[model samples]
Every structure is written in structure tokens, then in C-alpha cells.
Target chain A: MGYEEAFPPADMKWAGNAAKRFASPFVDVPHDRIDVDAIILSHAAVASGYTIRDFYEKPELGIHCVAYASAMYDLLPVTHWFFSLPWVTELGIRLEYKDTLPPIPAAGQEHVLKDPSDVDKIHVPDKNELDKGWTLPMFKRLYTYVQKNLGHTLVPISYGFDLVGAAAELCGVENFIMWTFTEEEAAKKLVRKYTETAVNGAEGLADTFGSAMLIVGSVLGNNDIFSDEAVKMYSADNMKYYVNQCFRKGAGPQVFYHLCGNHETDYKVFKDTLMWSPFTVIHAGYKARDPFPSALLKSEFQDRATCMGSVDTKLMIAPNPKAVYDQAKKQLLEGRDSKRGYILGTSCETPPYTIPGNIYALTRAARDFGTYGTW
Target chain B: MEVIMSDAVKELIGKRGLKVADVEEVVKNGKAIQKKGTNHYIASKMIGDVTAYAEYDLESGILKKKANVTSAYSHRIKLIKVDKLDEVSDYVMGSTPVHNATLQMEYMTVVRSGPGLATADGSVLMVEEYLATKTLAVAEGLFEKKRA
Candidate 1:
């Protein structure tokens, strides 16, 4: 199983509803005859109003299956892996980089960022092209480096989930929402086109560099833009259509649907549309209205879907380490009782304001209370 | 969950020098436990000038009865502790000093908001003492302008 892309393709009108389009990789990998079990699609959609069918042109690709794979090497030095492995055929790597959008100008010659929230972490104008032109070459470079260096661990180099909210920032919220209802056909065409461009780029890179796995993500689940009704009506069908097309294509890459928002109502729709049976992982803040009551979601999904994210991120920033620890403990206990897969994570991004002591508490709870079994 | 009086509460009662007999009648007469959600908020209310009771059955415990305060109200019991005599007396006596301290603190931390502060709506609130003082000052000609 592979995890879905957390990021989304720029200009996807219903990117917030992209979670609904999630397809499990386990289903598609066998169809595509790929030995790899998982894949990720960084945020690249097809042309306006076009479906995933239009992108891959075949129906065998598993572009919507979501699952999680190991990232054992992401935190380690790439050079070390190059020198160590001699028996493997290819190198697998996960690439993540910050965005570079120019700060909004307050006055002439003085650039002022509206929110001093992520002042230190963000830079200007280094964003992934929404056009999906550069991602292919980037993958090629990464794969080539891996193959030329040691030719080991080269299986599935999941690309990324790009800057979560970057696309919304590029094309303001109101315009994006209006595009969904007013220009539905055009929007679908654009998604299909962009998605194809990205897949083409990914495929070209894969063939050239001798890589297998494809990974992608960005913020497609944030609820600040479209409402649930609009998503269900316009976005859900398109997501399903695209995922179906990916299945038709012979792309061995598994699909992953990732996002970072509190979209509780869309869970059923996401599961239905993505068809995440037997394989895949759904990682987000599944904040049920009643935590004690909704503990069953963990058991119901089992290995098919793993709910991630730590207790609310606000706990740590509240200067309450105990709150963080307690939340983790509660989630693990809930997971154990429900017989479902649970991953320790934050509800959202690990903000710079977060205290390091509270962050470490997550590890402590996992160590103290974790066990290996469903629930 | 069983509710047990904490050691801090016991020490507090001891510090107040209250005995079980002091609240014997209140405990006997104070029926009906205040149902706070699922838990009981057992408390008692004083009816007469009696500050102490004759005797209390520590084993049988306080009697329980239906609440009769108001038709629309929920059931709530008036809790009577062996140490409530000192608690109530100290509470009533402490009020005057607390108010005095608050007044002193107000003077020390005065804010100038045009001599008035509005609430949620644009309605000004004037302190009753300030209003009375101002009215008296005007009656006594204390606020009158002198001849230039």
C-alpha cells in the first residue's frame, strides 16, 4: 500500500476533494504488473475538465490508490546509501523542498509578508511549477544520481507532496471556488492535462534513470476553500474518473492521496470514491465530533487505512507537554481498542512555534504505549 | 466513582476548629443530593438562626429526599459538613475586607477611558458610589467654579 499525495496539482478546482479520488495501490500494482506495492503522485493534475482517462490514455494505471511505504533513507545521508548497497538494482529516494513564492508587497519596494507565521522557513519564488514541466527532469536527476552512485536500493523513489497550500496561494481562493461551479468542464480538462503532463514527466524520468516508484503529495484536504456539498457534487466524480483511468494505464507507480485539514464529513465519500480496500493508507486529522464514539473508524479500516496525526497541534503550542503526551496516549489506547492502524502525527504541519519538548513527547508515548497489531 | 473528602479538606476543617455536632441538624434536615449532570452536588442551605445541631448519626449518614426548591429547577442537595460552621462564618466576615481591598486595588490601577466604559452595546456604566459622590459634591457646591 502507498500513501496519497498530500499536495495537489495547482489549478485543481476541487483539490480539496482530491481525497475522494484516492485509489489503493495494491489493486493497481497487480493490474499494471509492477512488483512495487505503493506509489505517490505529487500535486499534478491533468488539463481543464479532462479526466485521468485523458492523461494516461489507458485504464490500468493506479493513480488513485493510497498507501504508506518506508522512508528509512529520507533522514539519512544519500551518499552513505550510495557507498553501501551493491546488490540492489536501483535507488529509491523521497524528495521534499520548501516553496519560494515572493512575499506580497505592502508598499513600493518594501515586501511585507502578510502573515509573519512561517517567516524563517519560507523563501521566495522557488515553488514547483503548476505546469508540471520541471518535475520530470528533477526525478531524472535524482534517479540518475542514485543509479550512477551505487545502483542499490533503487526501487520506488516516491517524489513528493509539494508545499501544501501553495496552489491556493497562487490562484486566490474565490477564483478557485468559482472555477468549480462555473467552469466545471474546463476545470476537468485542465486537471487531466496537467495530470498527464506530470505523469509523462514522471514516466520519462523513470525510464531514463531506471527508477520504479512514483510518489507525490501536497495539501488537497484543507477546507478553507470549497464546501462539502460542492466537493461531493463536482469534485468527487472527477476524482473517481481520474483514478479509474490511472488504473487502465500500465504505470506501475502506486497512487497516494494525502492532505492536511479537518474534513470529517468527507471520510465516507473518500473511502467510496478511492476504493481503498485491502491496501492503502489515509493520513490526516480524523477529528470526530466525539472522540470516544468514533474510535471504531480505526478498526473498520484495519490495514487498509491508517489514520495519522498526533493529537491537536494546538496542545503543544499551548505550552502543555502533558497535553501532547496525554493526547498520544489516548489515540494509541483508542487504536488498540478499535483494532485499527494508527500512526502518531500532528493534526497539521509541525509549526515552527511548536516546543521541542512537546514534540519529543510523541516519541515517548509511542515507546511507552505502542504495540504491533491491528488496534 | 466514589467521592471521598480529601486530606486538604479535612485539615481545612481542623484549622477552622469545627466539630461534627456543629452541623448535626443541618445534615439531618438537609435532604436531597444536588444532581450535577451524573454526579451529585450535595450542599445545604441555612433556614433559621440555628448555627449548630443536637446530634448526628455518623453511621446512617445524612437523609436523602426529593428537591422542592422550584418546579423548573433540578434536584440539588444542601451539603452539611462537620466544619461548615467555621466556613460560613469566615466567609461572611471576609466579604467586607475583600471589598475594601478591591476598592484599594481599583484606585491603584485606574484607567482613563473618558470617565466611562461601554459594554457590548454602547451603554455607559457609572459606579453607584461615584454617581452618589458626584451628586453630593454638586449639592454642596464643591464642584462649583470660583469667581475668576
Candidate 2:
């Protein structure tokens, strides 16, 4: 059940060295000791009845590995800003205007779209304009490094883009809701502008990376914060537009869509919008009260795409290690029989405070019970 | 000088044994200072040897409280009065208290205005800075009561 038992020390050492060489500074563990890929696979194999080789052979798994690397290297600067504005304390990033404001300022003070009438002010930055700073060069260096060193084992992907979520960032959440109600036309225009920007950015990255799997990290389009009617009316169309734009003329690479938060009533919207698209993998978070059963995935999305995730993030922080193992084991056991290949992962981001022992426990459970014929 | 008195102001003035006419004489030529909230206004003046600080509710013209201090506590005591005005402004600008007589319940409701803790029901809990800024706006007469 231990990490070494699941992954040979040699494989762990190799992955650790790869992580250290490319991931430095960002990943806290020592260069020769960082083995996130082995950790992911050693645990994943236990749940999916697949060997490490079997996992890597699948392009989807490669995409996930690239997504993790992109995150570790901070390839997506936009996503980092999303985290920094709200949870800077948790991430230990200092705020620039801390002195002028009180100890903590309001969340939306940095919002750009203060007025609905100013939607026209939003502009999609050209590639050169976006590259004027370190983000572009750093991303290029990391992407090139990942593609060169880990390309054979894992695909190099951008953690991906989020149109609606980025729009929420530019337009304060309150103003976003206000505009949706009071100025529907302006809101639609804003969404269109951002969606086009997102598509352009994705295409640009895809061209640079030469075929990378992209992840939309937080399809805020599926968030319950907006009313069901509003989501149906506004968000649904925007998402459909994004999908169409990304796939049109082969503008971007294949996509893996990730959505968080309570979406009990809204999953149908995603299903309906994306049902026909061949360029997506849907990873949804779990609703603790109504866990996403494998049968539901089979019945609802079997023909369209593979489904991943729904392991409760709460288990990652549970007091007892056994709780984490038990939860991971239960999820794997259910997913072992799934016709659509299930990739076991936390329903949401593993919280910053989740302990290493709990993470190891997840892999331990997978290794112990994830044999091909065990189910 | 225009003097307005709330119930609390009358009590403080009566307890201190200061005449309203004397406080008004100083306030008439005082410098006006504002705080965070719309209703909070303070007027400070030095008359001969005594410095008088008067806190006023801008909306209703009610003098919430007044303090008179000799050179020693003049600055410190005036700050104290302004702080009191901030508290009153928070209560006034915050959501109105909801009371259910049938259930014998009473509680004030506040929207989650900034980044902080949130309740299970998704109500954002108030952060200290947000509370300070919001209440100060009310005290400074910068807050306008929104028409419901």
C-alpha cells in the first residue's frame, strides 16, 4: 500500500528528477524527490485497473500530466491572477496596494468593467501585446522544456482558458450580475468579446505548442452562482460559441473541460451544449449530497465522451488517512466497472492545506484495489 | 450654529454638565470633518481655552454626542467621539433588522460585501477592513441612503 510498493523507486527517482529540472522553485520538494507523475499514476492505476504504461498510452492521461506540469510551472498567468485576487494569503503572494487599503480590501476592487456601458472598452490582447512581459517568454520556455523532455511520456498542454470566469474577473461579480439583469445586450457583447479573446489565445497557444491538449480550468459557465434561467439564457450560448469557435478551422487543440462548484441542476446544460463536440473531455466536481454515480455517467454521457473526477476534496483534508484511502477506494471501485474510461481525481483542486500523507493514501488505495480483474 | 440632538447626545451632554449654547458657539466656527458613512459628520473648534468636538448625524441633523476637553485630551477625545459616530453609521447603513414576532426572533441582515469567510448558506461574512470602510463612509456623510 506504500508509495514505493506501487511505483518502483527507480521510476519515482526519474519522475522526481524530471520535475526538479523543469518544475524547480514552484514545486517545493527537492529536484530528485519530486515525483508527481508517478504519484498520479501509481494511484491512478489502482483505480483504473491500468498499469503506468497503460495510463501513459492513453492520450487523455498524457493531457492530464501536461496540465499538472503547466500548473506547477505557472504557465497560465491568468489563472494565477484568479487565485491571487481572492486567496493571496493562502498562496503567500503579497498584494500590491496593501498599504493604501485596509488590512484586506474588497475582492472586486481590481475589476476593470466597472460600468456596463464600458463593455466596449474590453479588448483582446494581440499575441505580441500579451507577450510584452515575462508570462509569454516563461510559458514558451516551460512549454518547450516540457515538450522536449517529457513529450514522449506526457503531452505538453496549457492548463487551458476560461472565458466566462475571466469575464467575471474583468467585470466584478456584482456588476456582472447587475448587467445581466439591467443591460442584457451589453452583457452579451462582453461575453462575445471575451469568448473571441479566449478562442484566439487558445489557438495561438496551440499553434506554438504544435498540438497540445487544453484544459478549461473552471468553466464558470456551469457555476450555480448565476440563476438556472440566466445560465440557460446567457452562459449556455457563450459556452456553445466558445466550443464552436475553438473547433472551427481547427483553431485550437483538443479540450478537457473542468468545472467546479455545485452544479446539480446545470450539468444538463453542459451535456446538451457539448454533446455533439468531439473535442472535449468533461471533468465535473462531486456534489457531496448527490455523488455522481458511474451509471449516471454511462447513461448520460457514454456516447459523447469520457468522464473524469468526482472524488470529494474533503477527503484530502480528513483527519484520518484511512478516510482518504477509503474514499479513493470507493470511487475507484465504482469507476472500475465503468465502460467510459474513468480518470480518478479530486472533484476539485486539492486544497492548499491537504497533507502529503492523505495524498499518498489515495494512491495507496488505488494500488491495492485497482488490478484489472479485481472488480 | 445649528445643533441637533439625538437621545444619546442629550444623555451625554446632561451627564457632562455642559450648556448646549456653549457647544454651539464653538461649533459655529469649527472645521468640518467627515468619516466613511454618509450620516457621520464632526465639527471641531477651539474656543478660548476649551476645544469642543461635536458628532452629528447628517441625514437627520441629530447631534449624536459632544465632548469637551482641555489641551491634554482634546485630540484623543475627539478621535473617540468620531469612532462612536462610525459605530452608529454602521448600524444605520447596514441592512435593517428583520423581526419575526410569531417566532419571537430579531436579527440584523448584512450582505456579504467583500472577500472573507462565508456561511454555509453562502452569505459572505464581514471582514474588519470592509466593516471599517463601510461604517466610516456613513460617519463622513459620504454614504447616501439608497431608496428602497
Candidate 3:
């Protein structure tokens, strides 16, 4: 194989934007002089994608830039790679970060009919006033703008799988779970509401970006926030409902599902979902004492899908490069036996604070052990 | 802003959803009523205004109050202060006050950690189970009073 790509392209201006939005304390590389093989356009405003394109277009520093778009499954900022077309290489989304979040659409542009039963459960206080149906058009505008101005692929976003957290946020976690057992009818109706909106959004993306894939997104692993019962009731069936209705019917681009937790329990949900075997599974962590081996997924879906990084971002910040190198080696060795489609990467988003030498070490490990033959 | 009630008085006040102040009013009723220490053998006159009271019963499980209805009664009936909010919360099983009534209660204990109740200190509560027949009797009497 060849050398694997290092994200946070050296030339891109993420620092200034990071500081502007996140109030990052450290200075980032100047956008004009940054260098990178590709760009993972995080889930943010329009300027993020443009900044990456401009870096590559500069006459002084030429590089190949791929626009990795975030999904719209929830309010969080995370990307989902939903295209199989050769022009858009699919790099899976991260669970720890945010997703592409556009402000709720303006009201009256389109009628967002609510299922009769879900009228009371819709949290947006004035549901009729929000532009629920116009997400597709706005996205189309974003795609058209990016493609025309920057010449990048209009990857249809696979958004809106963070329903578990969304539900918990709207209703406290204890009450949400309590509602399922106590208020059975109301709970079922709420789940149906969440699933239906997601399906509608999926149809919108598919309709706009015809050659696009669906990304089932989730933040299922926040202190077991995706409680077993919550997962069984809300996540499992709702995902099946949306994917079958919206994603499965679409043409072009194999669908991908992105999860942000260790996913210790939902592995079954991941393997069995109707979407195309994922193009990439990002951020499944590897712990030293996890009862089962990390290699288990390799045996199961390695041939069917691509496995992204497994090196824990926390482990990479060790004082020396050797520790980073050692951990990366361990991950490759564990994964090498499966030897199908493998992309050596961190178990979660590579934190910006990661040491550069360690980042280089990861690139080296992917080159060294990410190959098909003997390590 | 203080509300206090004994286990027996609180139960007479009903459990659906009542504040301490509401229970306190019932204990200090002006009408002549049977009072046995913390227990009130009979509370002939419901103390709080109808609007302030969430219709509920002290027995027949907490689930009985899931519905709402209103009835005017001119006469008062007898009630035994079998248990109060503190004693009921103590014996109610499971994680919540509602769950306690649903689950078995042989080994249940009252919440006693003073620092835990964010609203105040010394805010411990209890729960207790009456004899099986009295369970239904108390529930019947509470709803009976609702009609009167």
C-alpha cells in the first residue's frame, strides 16, 4: 500500500478559526503556508470548507484536497462520508466532535407536516414556524456554492443519528428512560417522531445529492447514556425505520454509519443495519482490559467495511514518540491478522494538542503495519 | 419556606403530589378530628384548597392517582393516619417514590443523607406498608372523601 494521510493539513487555517469559535489559546499554523495531502472539513459554517480549498489552490503550495463533509443526524458537529463516487473518497466521521449544523430553516418556506400523534411532542416550540422541510434546499445551496466557487464534490450529508442524546437532553436521562416503562404510548410516539423526521431529512439529502450515501450518526456512549433499554426502544428500531425508508432507496454512494463511543454494546446494531456495510467505522476504542479482544470486529466486518483508526488519542500524548509508536504497533499487530480493508487511525478524533512527532509516528505505523503482508 | 409533616399526617394528606406546606395545613385543621400522636385516626375535613391538592390516595398503590376527577362532598369521613410522606418514602422500594410502591418493600430504608437533599438539611423522608386489607380500605376512603 502507500502512505496514509495525516488530517489537520499542515497548511489549513484551523487555529484562527478554532480560536475564533472555541477560544483556542495556542496559535495555529498560518493558513497561507499550511501544507496537507487532504482536508477533513469539520461540521461548521461555510468558511471551514472554503479555507481548505483555498489552501490547495494557492499557486505557491499545491496539494490534493478532499472535502470530508459532516452529517446532520444531530446538533453535534461531526462529519459522515456518504459517497461511493470516485471523486469523493469517504473518510468516516468522528464521534467526539460536532456535525454540520445549519440553523433551523426559516418558517413558511415549506410545510413540515407533523404526524398527527406527534403534535405535542415536537420540542421546537413553534414547529410550524421552523423551516423543517427546507434543509434540503439550503444544503443544495451549500453544495452548489462549494462546487462552483471551490470545485469540490457535493457529498450529500448523512445527518441525524444522535437521537439518544437528543432525547435525553430534551427530557432528563432518568425521566426519558422512565417514560418508556411508565408512559408506553407517549414514549413510542416520541420515538416515531424522531425516526420520521430523520427519515424526512435523509430523503432530503438523497434527493438533493443523488449520488450520496446516508450516515447513521450516534453519541451512544456517554457514561452508558445509551442505556440498554433506551437503545432497544429508541435507537434500534428508529434507525431501522429511517435507513430502510430514506437511505436504502437512494442510488449512488454506499451508505455509512458513524458512532462516537466505544460501542461496546451496539456492535450488533452496527453489523446488522440495512445501510451498505460502512465505508469506514471511526473511533471504536481499544482498552487494555476490555474482556473481549479488539480484534473481534476485524473478524466480523473487516472484509465488508473499512476500519478507521483504533489508537486512543489519549494514549498518543505520552511524553515520547516511542510510546505513540509502540501503541500504534500494538493496534496494527492486533488488526493485521484480519488484513482486509484497514485504515490505521485513532480510536477517537485526534485531539489538536497531540504532539507532531507522534502524529508522524502514526503516519509511519500506517505505512509500516497498515500493509497487507507480514509486519 | 418550610414544610414539615409526620408519617401518619402526610399519608392522610395523600401522596399523588403534595408539598410539605400542604400537609402541614391538614395537620393543623380547625375542625375536630381524631389525632393519635403522629397518626390521625380521622381527618373529617380535607384541609387544603381543592386547586392546591393533586388528587391522590395514601394506599392502593401510588398508581391510583394517575387519573384526575373532581367531586363535591358536604360530609367528612374517618381516616387512620396509617403512614406519612417520610415513612412512605422510606419503605417505597426501587429508585423513586413511585417505583417504591410497585416493588417489594421488606428491606426498604428511608433516605437519610442530609447533604443529599439540595433544597435543605435534615430533609429525610420515609415509607411504610400497612396491612393488606387496610391498603385497599385506605385507598377506598380517600377516593370516597373525593366524592363527598
Q: Worst lDDT window (10 residues) for model 3 chain B?
A: B110-119
Give the CAPRI class of candidate 3: incorrect
True contacts kept of each: 0.00, 0.00, 0.00
Model 3 lDDT tens row, B2-117: 22335654454454444445443433341221212321222113444322222222223243411111111211112212111211222111222211111111101110000000
Top-lDDT candidate index: 2
Docking class for model 1 is incorrect
TM-score of each: 0.42, 0.51, 0.46
Query: Per-model C-alpha lDDT, please?
Result: 0.32, 0.43, 0.36
**Candidate 3 ranges beyond 4 A from true positions:** A1-138, A149-154, A172-174, A221-223, A226-230, A248-253, A273-283, A286-293, A316-320, A337-340, A372-375, B1-148
Q: What TM-scores result for chain A when each predicted structure is judged separately against the true chain A? A: 0.54, 0.68, 0.60
Task: Give lDDT: candidate 1, residue A163.
Answer: 23
Considering the two chains of model 2, state its CAPRI-style docking category.
incorrect
**Residue-wise C-alpha lDDT for candidate 3, range A102-221, written one tens digit per residue:** 122223332122233333546431112222433344445545544443332234554545555444333444555566667666655655655555555555555555534455555542
* lDDT, candidate 2, B1-148, per-residue tens: 3455656655665554445655565455555434444555445555444345555554432455433322111211111101000112232213431110100000111110111112222221211222112222221121111111
* Model 3 / residue A308 / CA error / Å: 2.9
Model 2, A1-375: lDDT tens per residue?
322233222233444344343322121111221112111322233233344343333333323333343333222111111121222221122333332221233444555666787788766664455454323344455555445444433343443355555565566656776777898888878767766655555455555754444455445655456766666556666665665454442332245666566666666666555412222456667442444554565455544454554557776667788977787677666654443344455676555345557767765665565444445
Cα distance off (Å), candidate 3, residue B67:
57
Of candidates 3 and 1, the better by lDDT: 3
Tens digits of per-residue lDDT for model 1 on A13-93?
Answer: 222122211111211211111011111111111212223332122111112211111121011011110111110111111
